[model samples]
Target chain A: MQSIERLVLLGTGLISGSFALALKRARLVKRVVGVGRNIENLERALELGVVDEVSTDAAQAVRGADLVLLGTPVGQMGRLMQQIAPNLPVDCVVTDGGSTKQDVCALFRENLPRHLAMCVPGHPIAGSDLSGASAAQFGLYEGRRVVLTPLPENDLLVVEWVRQLWVSCGATVYEMSAEQHDGIFSAVSHAPHLLSFAYMNSVLDRYNAEQCLDFAASGFRDFTRIAGSHPDMWRDIALANRDSVLGDLKANVAQLNHLIQLLESGRGDELTGFIQRASRARIEWGKPKKG
Target chain B: MQSIERLVLLGTGLISGSFALALKRARLVKRVVGVGRNIENLERALELGVVDEVSTDAAQAVRGADLVLLGTPVGQMGRLMQQIAPNLPVDCVVTDGGSTKQDVCALFRENLPRHLAMCVPGHPIAGSDLSGASAAQFGLYEGRRVVLTPLPENDLLVVEWVRQLWVSCGATVYEMSAEQHDGIFSAVSHAPHLLSFAYMNSVLDRYNAEQCLDFAASGFRDFTRIAGSHPDMWRDIALANRDSVLGDLKANVAQLNHLIQLLESGRGDELTGFIQRASRARIEWGKPKKG
Candidate 1:
C-alpha cells in the first residue's frame, strides 16, 4: 500500500484521533494534520503523536491533503464538509467516522458535489462514552467492524482506498446501502439507547427515585449504562435517523404492550415462552462462534 | 451472637448455599441441612461444605432444624412451606430469600399460618446469573444489602435475629413493608429485565435479525445482559409482582410515547432536554455517594 502524502482530520477526537494513531503505527501516512475548534485538544493530540501538525482551519488543513477524515458528530459534518470542499485536492479521497450514514451522504452531495466521486461515507462500529482527542489510542480499531455506505457516484478506486485504509488500521470493512445501514443500526443501537433513556426518565419520575436507585443492583447498572451517554450526540443521532429510530421505537412499544397484556391476563405459559425466546437468542449470541 | 443448633435450607441453590456458608464462617450455625429436588446439587453442596447434611424431603429436613431458610423460587415456596408446616419445630425462625416479598408473604400466611410469628420474610439483593449450589461462595453477601420485609405477626425478636444474622454475614439489612419491597424491586429490577426481554424479542421478530445481532456492539451487550437470565426465574418474578411490574411497564410505555412524539415533530431542543434528563440522572446515579 502506498503511503498518503498528507492526511487531514476534521474535528480531531476519539474516533479520528484513534484512526490517525492506528494509521501512523502502520506507517500508512507521512504527515497528519489535525483540525478542531478546541486548541487544547489539538495540542494534546499533537503531543500524544496522534497527529504531526495541528490546524484550527478545516479548509487550510485540507489544502494539500490527499485524504480527509470527517470524524465529528453527524450534526457538524455538513458545515465541515462545506468548509473543506473548495480547498480539497481533486484526487483527495474523503471518508467519515460518523455513526449515521444517509445524512452524511446527503451532506457530502450538498456541500461537495464536485468531490462526490472521491467521497465514501463510512461508520466505524467502535464507540466509547469517552470523547475528545485525549481518549484516542493505537489499535482502537483492531478486530472492529466498519460499515461503508458509498455514494452511487463514488469512484471504485476511491472506495477501495477507503476500505484498504480501514483494513490497514486492523478493522474488517463491510459494505451496505445507506438505507440498510441506518435501518440495521436503528434497530440494534439507536432504539436500544432511546429505550434505555426512556426507562431512566421513568425511574427518575418516581417519588422514591432516590430510594429506588439506592437499592438498584447490577442488573439496573448494566441496563441503564447507555442512558448516561452524551445528550447532544444522541440527540443528533435521534434526529438525523428519526425515521428509522421512530419505526424501531414503535416496534418496541408494540412489544411492551404485548408484554403488558400477557402479564395482565396472567398467561404463564406464553409469558415463559416469550422470555424463553429472548433468553435463548441472547444466550446463543453470547456463545463463541466458529468462523 | 447465639448460634442456632441446625439451619435447614429449603432449596440448595446460590442464595441458600451462600447463606449457609456465610453462617458457617461466622460460627453462628452448628449444622447446615440443604434440601433440594436435585440430589446431585445436594451432594455437591455437602462435598463443598456448604451444608453439613443434604435432604430431598422438606418435611424431613426441617424436623430438627431450629432455623429454616426458604431459599427457593417464590413459585416453590408455598409448596415447600406446606410440606414442612407439620414438621417444622415450633420455635424455628423461618426466613426466606425470595426476590418478591408480597407473594412470599402470602405463601407464608396461606401454608405456614401457625409459624407466622417466627417467620421473617427477607430478600437478599445480591444476585447472579449463575445458580445451583456449585455457584455459592463465602463472600457473596459481603457488602451486599438485604431487604427484610417482615410480616406483622413476626416476633420482634425473630426479626432482630434475622437482621443480625444477615449483618454477621457482612450484609447491611433494611426493613420495609412487603408492598414497598415489591414496588421498589418492580421499578428497578423486574421492570428492566422484562423490558430487555421484550426488546430482544422485538429484535428477533425482524427479518434481518441475524444481521442486527451480528452488528450489535457494547451498548446492546450491556442493555440485554439481563435478557440472557433464567427465563423460568424471570417469568416467576414478572407474574409474582404483576401489578407493580405492569404499572412500571405502562409508565415506560408512556415515556416511549412521549419520546416518539418529540422525535416525530423533530423537536430538537425538547429531545435534547429529554435525553439530558435521563443522561444526568443516570450519571448521578452512577457516581459514588457519601452515604
Candidate 2:
C-alpha cells in the first residue's frame, strides 16, 4: 500500500489519537497533525507522540494534506467539514470515524458537496466509556471492525484507500449502505444505550430512589454501566440516528409491554419460556466469534 | 459465638456450599451435611470439603442438626421445609439463604408452624452468576451483607445467634422486614434482570436479528450480560417477588414512554436533561463508598 505523506486528524480524541498511534506503529504515515479546540488536549496529544504536530485551526491543518480523518462526535463533524472545505486539497481523501453513518454522510453532502467523490463515512466498532486524547492507545483498533458507507458519488479508489488504512490499523472492514449502518447500530448500540439511560431514570423516579440505589448490586452495575456515558456525545448519537433509534426504542417498549402482560397474567410457563429464549440467544452471541 | 455442632444445608449449591465453606474456615461449624436432589452435586460438595457429609435425604439429614440453613430457590423452600419439619428439633435454629423473603416467610409459617420460633428467614446479598458446588469459595461471604427478617414467634436469642454465626463467617448482618427486602431487591436486582431479558428478546424479534447481533459491540455485551442468567432461577425470583417486580416493570415502561415522547418531539434539550440525570446518578453510585 502507498504510505500517507501528510495525515491530518481533526478533533484529536480517543478515536483520532488511537488511529494516529496505530498508523505510526504500522509505519503507514510519515507525519500526522492533530487538530482540536482544547489546547491542553492538543498539547497532550503532541506530548504522548500521537501527533507530530498540533493545530487549532482545522482549515490550516488540512492544507496540502493527502488524508484527513474527521474523528469527532457526529454533531461536531458538520462545522469541521465546513471549516476545512475551501482549503482541503482536491485530491485529499476524507473519511470520518463517526458512530452514525447516515448523518455523517448527510453532513458531508451539506458541507462538502463538491468533495463528495473523496468523502467516505465510516464507523469503528471499538467503543469505550473513556474519552479524550489520554484514553487513546496503540492497539485500540487491533481485532476491531470498521464499517464504511461510501456515497454514490464517491471515487471507488478513495473508499478502497480508507479501507486499506483501517486494515493497516488492524481492523476488518465491512461495507454497507448508510441507512443499513444506521439501522444495525440503532438496534445493537444506540437503542441499548437509550434503554439503559431510561432504566436508570426509572430508578431515580422512585420515591425511595436513594434506598434503592443503596442495595443496587452487580446486576444493576452491568445493566446501567452505559448510563454513566458522556451525556453530550450520546445526545448527539440519539438525535443523529433519530429515525432508527425511535423505531428500535418503540420495539423495545413493545417488548416491555409484552413482558408486563405475562407478569400480570401470572403466566409462569410462558414467562420462563420468554426468559429462556433471551438467555439462550445472549449466551450464544457471547461465544467467541470471528470478526 | 457458640459454634454449630451440626449444620444441615439443604439444596447444596453455590450459596449453601459457600456458607458451609465460610463456616469451616472460621471453625464455626463442627460438621456440615449437604442435602440435594442431585447426587453428583452432593458428592462434589463432599469432595471439595464444602460439606463434611453428603445426603440425598433432607429429612434424614436434619434429624440431629442444631442449625439448618434452607439454601434453595424460594420455590423449593416449601417442599424442603415440609420434608424436614417432623425431624426438626425444637432447639434447632432454622434459617435460609433464599433471595426472596416474603414467600420464604410464608413457607416457614405454612410448613413449619411448630418451628417458627426457630425459623429465621434470611438473604445473603452475595449474588453471583456462577452456580453449583464447584462455584463455592471460602471468601465468598468475607465482606458480603446479609439481611435477616426474623419471625415474630422466633426467640430473640436464636435470632442473635444467627447474626453471630454470619458475623463469624466475616459478614455484617442487617435486620429488615421481609416486605422491605423484597421491594428493595425488586428495584435493584430483579427488575434489572427482567429489563435485560426484555431488551435481548427485542433484538431477537427484529427481522435482521442475526445482522444486529453481528454488529453488537461492548455496550451490548455489558447491557445484556445479565440476560444470560439462569432462566429457572430468575423465573423463580420474578414470580416469588411478583408484586414488587410488577411495579418496577410498570415504572420502567412509563420511563420508556416518556423517553419516546422526547425522542419523537425532537426535543434535544429535554432529552439531554433526561440522559444527564441518569448519567450523573449512576456515576455517583459507581464511586467508592463505605459499605
The deviation in Å at residue B191 for candidate 2 is 0.3
Q: What local lDDT does model 1 show for residue A286?
A: 90
Pairs of residues at least 3 apart in sequence or in different chains that clash in candidate 2: none
Off by over 4 Å in 1: none
Model 1: per-residue Cα lDDT over B1-291, one tens digit each: 778899999999999999989998998999999999999999999999999998898898898888999888888888899899999889999999999999998988999888899999999999898999999999999999999998889899889999999999999999999999999999999999999999999999999999999999999999999999998899999999999999999999999999999999999999999999999999998999786
lDDT of 1 by residue, A209-242 (tens): 9889999999999999999999999999999999
Model 2, B195-233: lDDT tens per residue?
999999989988999999999989999999999999988
Listing candidates in order, what is each one's chain A TM-score? 0.98, 0.98
lDDT of each: 0.93, 0.92
Q: What is the lDDT of residue B141 in candidate 2?
A: 86
